[model samples]
Target: MPIRAGEWLAHGSQPEWTMTVVEKTQGAPRDAGPLAELDDHGLVAACLAGRRDAFDLLVDRHKRSVYLLCYRFVGTHEDASDLSQDVFLRAYRGLRRFRGDSSFATWLYRIGVNVCLNRVSMRQPLQRSLDEMPNLAAPQADPAVALVRREEARRVRAAVARLPRKQRTALILRVYHDLPHKEIASALGTSVGAVKANFFHALANLKKLLAADTRSGS
Candidate 1:
């Protein structure tokens, strides 16, 4: 019962659309009571036991955060949506290898970070700013204020993008995703101290970039 391309509506509340898509794709039962009550570990066990809908439950639970993380990395709705789907697909394929060394969320985040980095590496230089991307404003906000906000967001994103790869990843995970240092270290496959150092340098570099942008009257 996956939603067909023609059946998908572009206009609607985001959460509503996301749930509709998840329900359709997973074909989850209407009585998802027990499945929904199980924790991540339980759901993972169910998925391994051939309960494909259990995996869909995971998707429904985590999709919003995953989408937001992808959006932060790519700064566009379309790319983020595609990347989020890719993350879940990759997670599904790799489920057998999941050893429970970290939380499921952390493990999934590691996959997402790797996928985004690979995508970024393969793309042209990030010449597009956040303002030029999408979804930085409310529907009825003042146009002038929204423009200013977009410009500021664009400047910050540009600065973050210019950091060394590790630093950039650390900053995005820490600030944008609000992951703890230990969780971030697990995701990046680095030590906690290293993650801290990367975040420190990222902040320093961001300050300098923002200052420069301000001075240049951008």
Candidate 2:
């Protein structure tokens, strides 16, 4: 599909989520002024002009987000890596077709979510288990810190993975990807209200799941 630019809309009550930016081409209206200063559209433009190096800047910028998206959606480093490659490769090949009508990351995540959905649809029932997918991205911490952080991340991913498809997508897109509701709608191919509804259910379930995990541990 041809890309449109900057249509990443947010809900009226979006949470304050800061995103890292990346570098972009000079003299563009949105130059990547600071390292990680590049916006979605700028990266798209540079990559489309045969500047593969520009794509690296975008990769470095969103790699963690994309990797986390994969981990949350699939719960395994194996599948996430597979899907991450699919996401970026699809982007690279499809860049020329983009019309710059949406934020590049939004469009990219639309790709990510769809990729996950397709993977889920193709899985066998027994293969759909969630408890095995752990968040392997925990930062280096003291033994106690690592234990606490890893424990929390594991609990969160398990809860998120158990959510129904819509809820999981909404929760991950909003909480993990830091996208607003409307952009999430665009990515999920749904409405803003639906996105909110899904996010609510997903978060509620995650909280419940976390509470249960805590109670069990205690």
Candidate 3:
């Protein structure tokens, strides 16, 4: 059962969505060093030395954040899972090129942003069906109140998805990921000033979109 490059790993309910296994390295330890004991740099170095398990560890550590970031852009668990897997595959293939100019997380975020932007650009703007919308209800909350909140949140997500690519990326990195302006700029490959501008404009556009939705409902 050796996984080969370009093979798919089925994830979740999306049987059509597959994560590619970019390369299989020899001499990778079956039971390698405890990944929790190593820093990113250490794991990366181990991976370079043909320890495949190190990369698995790296994936385990960052996959949640990466998946959440993907979900913010695509607005579906299936698409986000697909994109997140793609991000990791790209990261694995590009590991040797990493020069440590930034933290590994920042570098990974940059890759994820690029992958998402490319995918987003090739398709029509994302629109979530009611079934695709997230359930944002709290236990014991009134059903009516929860429904209203969920609808509002969905509107906001839709508004964000409709933003210009750069603005959307900047806003997601800053607001959702809680990344600072400098880190966001690093992730987006832009200047700090530019990141701030994009965030400002994204918020302004979201306000307009949401307000229009509210006014129409009144």
Alpha-carbon local distance difference test for all models: 0.83, 0.74, 0.84
Clashes of 2: 16
Model 2 per-residue lDDT tens digits across residues 113-197: 8888788778722233334644345556576776676667667777777789899899888887789999999877789999999
Off by over 4 Å in 2: 1-43, 124-145, 207-218
As a TM-score, model 3 comes out at 0.81
Who wins the lDDT comparison? 3
195: Cα error in model 1, Å: 0.5
Model 1 Cα shift for residue 177 (angstroms):
1.1
Residue 63, model 1, lDDT: 89
Candidate 3 overall Cα lDDT vs. reference? Answer: 0.84
On a 0 to 100 scale, what is the lDDT of residue 25 in model 3? 45
Worst 10 residues of 1 by lDDT: 12-21
